[model samples]
Target: MASLLCWCLEAVLVAVLAVVGGVSGQVEAATPRRELVPAMFVFGDSLIDNGNNNNLPSLAKANYYPYGIDFNGGPTGRFSNGYTIVDELAELLGLPLIPAYSEASGEDMLHGVNYASAAAGILDITGRNFVGRIPFGQQVENFKNTIDRITENLQSVDVAQALARCLIFVGMGSNDYLNNYLLPNYNTRNEYNGQQYANLLVQQYTTQLTRMYNIGARRFAIAGLGLMGCIPNILAQSPTDSCSDQVNQLVQPFNANVKAMIGNLNANLPGAKFVYIDITRMMKDILVRPAAYGGQITCLPFQTPCPNRDEYVYWDAFHPTSRVNVIMGRRAFNGDESIVYPMNIQQLANLDLQPNNG
Candidate 1:
């Protein structure tokens, strides 16, 4: 009886220890919920550009007047009359206004930075017709150089880690087709149709995105081609006030394929989230039904509602107005089943509990 009692006590003690250990392990395994901070880093072409290429000898630049006329009633180097998508995104996040990366006096480095060029594209050859367009490789190099400068300038900085937290916004590829292949000088349309062109562009983009991922970009907002066919520049080619079905046909597949590429990238890269914005469809919706958006049918005289710039389509010929860009950014942030989705930049930022009150 004594021996049996001793054995039973030992067994009870072991069981008690095991239970305590298990509970302790579970407690250690629990992770605290992370609060999302608003730190956007934009890099792309004119649609969301903030004048990174103003000084660069590229014809893709928009540092002149009339571009930012709507911004502060003066040129701010942004391609739009007012704020671009990145600027509005900063406001939505409640962060301070995003400054151009080129600004010598405004290099805060913490809030956000804009590195978009006017006519830059994924392919180096795309902007040949655009006078002085910078290539994707050159842009990437510049981005890296900027990061280095930031690290050297800031004290107690983990340059690699800071970049990981910064949201990378990249929009390219439009010029690759529009100015390079489709322009009168090149016109690859006669050889490779729209689908083929899109595939080529996507392949080039995949390489560039991979390079970015390798360079400490964990958070990304990768925008695809906008309504290139509907732009005033392309539409002017039609001359009859009709839409450019040729450009539209090419653009449709390009957006779809680009979205697919984003999905694939997300799957392949662990913990990488890439959101594709369908600005083409959104732009079309406004153009097809201007009254639905609460805007008039004509923006100016002599131009028909469609021509006059009713809420119908474009602002001038090349870009959307600042208001539309804000809407597009919001939609892109939100995601599918949203206004357009996989959540636009605005909606994604909302998921973060951190303050972005810019």
Candidate 2:
């Protein structure tokens, strides 16, 4: 009887331990994973641009004081006070921040390179106001150059395969609207209506993204245009300091077409995992409830480092504050289907791609 009791106690203890261990295992499993992708290849405008515009003879350059005040490397040409969207995304990916294509050398190209330039857009003439910006086409060319350099360092096939696995981020189009269509000096508006212009932009965008696919990019996280009318720059344009509903309406078609484009790309491009990031919705959410998201609606235009930078959503009339950028990055990284359709960047990164013919 005593032996039987002792055996029963042992069994109960084992059961308890097993239960406890299972709970502990569940807790451990709940922790977030890291480094969903091998590397991140960024291509966009000022939103994700790090320092590509620094050396260029352009008014859009942001490599100066107050720009990188919050960054470890001061004044690294990020338009925001610190940590652009790409910076935060890289941190979430467990990779070091990607260097701008202009500055990246030798080992810098190993992980990836950022070809985004401040004021850059899909159209070559989009940022003509800036005078010397690298448009989306030239950025792609720079990326091709980077690929050649990578091929020289590593085996061409290995580089190609690695690129197939990397995350490709594109966040253009906003500049196309803000710097080209809306500019008083530009004739884009005279040439096309909102619908026609959006269609034209999508047509060009499709070609550019296809070129990226031809060059081996498979996983894509493309950010749609945000609510340009709500930015301080546009808001200031209003005599009553109100948001421009007209400007906001103008870009809706672009966002809609971009969603359609993603669906089409996924259907047509084998091995393509295109995730559409709804910047329009994301920005509106933050703007609508600025207090909840820890953001302010406005900031002084073109001023040196606002002391209360954290409170303002607009860092300087145009760009979002670093805090807002961090929040935006987090949402883009792991947001629900509502914000990031099909999947988020995290999902895109972890998705298994089929064997590519390339």
Candidate 3:
């Protein structure tokens, strides 16, 4: 049955991509450029996690075969089979791929480090099911340690100046909903309605991002929540096998608050360029027409390998394939304001901010 499903999905993706191509014209490619940003510091959850979760005693790990089958280094711990969104973003920015925080040292810290851990969330307790995953707060602390190391190594390098000029990517909050509030065993749902919960998440998120700002992060690329209700895990719960409208609706406010937060941060923070990447819209666009994005709506179980990996939208029940990551990364890098509002990452990276002398 899995094989059949995989086969059908591959066919669907091929057709979808063809139709999408015919209608949308040629897809924009990421233009190679000189180092657009000084560095890219990443935080958040599995979506951007390269390998930080490998050593952690967590169930939310992807450190074995089939996980990095498409990636060159093989099971280096990215959730996807190949390059993550940050990896592609790094390429587009003309910087070397950002190393996972666990492995980074010396010169590796120069291009920035990725503190993203699979199963991480804005709230520390969000992914408690996974156990041992670094929370957003912890990731920030790890980044501070990285800064200390960098300063120690390059005594002449101005850490604050380097950070101010670098790009900070934050993609989180999905697990707070998926692994926390929505879980049957959790009390989060009883305490608050969807709107109230979203407010709570946003409040914590604001505090976390502010901490980053206080620590010298100035350029920000904040990815909004994607359509979690439409993922295969949620779809599997439905008797009709349809996307959960209720679940999808629940997350809309979180995305809205995130966008509002970006505006507020930009207005309040000196020299802060907070660019919002509308992953919600981008994923919906691809999900609505999987073929166009070379993605399959359904993913086979992790143990079962799909022959046409690039054609599948998702690699497992929750994460997108490396190909889809590339697609989304490229869009975030150069897509118009409709997809990545205010400005895309490319534009944000190239933006020159007046020194925050204050």
Candidate 4:
């Protein structure tokens, strides 16, 4: 009886310890963190756009109803129903939400500036169908203008050092595929095959990125194209109502080239550290369990979206919900090799990339 009592007591103690450990782990995760980097400069399309397109005369605007339904500040021109991936990423970095270049000024420009615009692409003519949108080439020019403003307050050397310490995230190429090549209005398909186009984009992209490095940027996180075929808009066009495999296969070359480009950039550019964000891999698990999320793929413009936004995957045919934004942001912040090549966002932020200043 004594031996049995001792064994029972040990089992009870083990269970109690396990419960306490689990609770403590949960609390630790909830703990607030300090800012990781000085600032984060964001550049991309509607996937990350936050109101830069609102004042533009582009037909690609999303500053209404279904778009900012979940946002604290309504209709911020983000495609999704609230916080974008960049917003979530800013939160993860313990930084305030970086303001759009259009609306940001004075102290707002200090933390960071988002240059992403709806319908923007790596190529100048990619989103012509939408008209009045800022292309990637012009966005870089806009950044130079921003640098001038930032220089007004800080010394030129200080501006360079601060920018080098900051994180520069650029997610391009989606519009290059969806709007430029695939659309009948554009002759991109006739001019170049998938491989050729990917090559052309990467070639141009190389120059744009080099310009960034020449100016000040040092730590970079370049986001690759995700599963564009898997988007609901693509699905709606599919006769079988499934992900278009052909479209998925077409963008692989672009993603692959971008990865190779990162390797080349890291090898040649001094003080430049660039990591590729594999968005396709980031969405893999979420894609497999579509049932857990609301099965709806497309949400019409101006129409009300699904009730439980978290349960939905695609906020609309093109963008993702706030739930996905947070998940992708968290993954990029801490995910392993499969998600972000060479290093992750958190690691990039921690890099002591104090520029030479010479």
* Model 2 accuracy (lDDT, Cα): 0.77
Per-prediction TM-score = 0.76, 0.87, 0.90, 0.89
The true-versus-predicted C-alpha distance at residue 339 of model 3, in Å, is 1.1
Candidate structures ordered by TM-score, highest first: 3, 4, 2, 1
Better of 3 and 4 by TM-score: 3
Worst 10 residues of 3 by lDDT: 1-10
Q: Worst ten-residue run, lDDT, model 1?
A: 1-10
Better of 2 and 4 by TM-score: 4
Model 3's number of clashes is 6
What C-alpha lDDT does candidate 1 achieve relative to the native structure?
0.60
CA lDDT, every model vs. true structure: 0.60, 0.77, 0.80, 0.78
Model 4 lDDT tens row, 1-358: 0000000000012222232234121111213578887889888898998989889888878777767877889888888777788887887788888999999999998889999998889999988888878888888898888989899888998888788888888999999999889989998999999999999999999999999888788889999999988887677677876789999999999999999999999999988899999999876666764433223433455554566555556667677776667667777888888988898999989877534631
lDDT of 3 by residue, 1-358 (tens): 0111222123235444553333232233446779988899999888888889889888877777667877779888887778788899999999998999899987888898999998888898888888879999999999878877777766534777778889999998988998899988889999999999999999999998998888788999999988888776776678876779999999999999999999999999888889999988887777676434323444333456766666667766777777678778888998999889799998888788896531
lDDT of 2 at 122: 91
Which candidate number would show the highest TM-score if scored against the true structure? 3
Q: On residues 1-358, what C-alpha lDDT tens digit does candidate 1 reach at each position?
A: 0000000000012222232234121111112223344467777777777767677776565555445545664666676656676766666566666676677343576666776676777777766665675577777776676666776776524656556666778878777776777777775767787788788888988887888777666677777676666565654456564557777777777787888888899788765667776667666554553323322222221222132111223344566665556556555655454344465665544433222211
> How should the candidates be ordered by lDDT, best one leading?
3, 4, 2, 1
Candidate 4 error regions (>4 Å): 1-31, 290-298, 354-358
**Candidate 2 local lDDT, 266-293, one digit each (tens):** 9999888899999888776766643332
Alpha-carbon shift of residue 257 in model 3 (angstroms): 0.6
Better of 1 and 2 by lDDT: 2
Judging by lDDT against the true structure, name the best candidate: 3
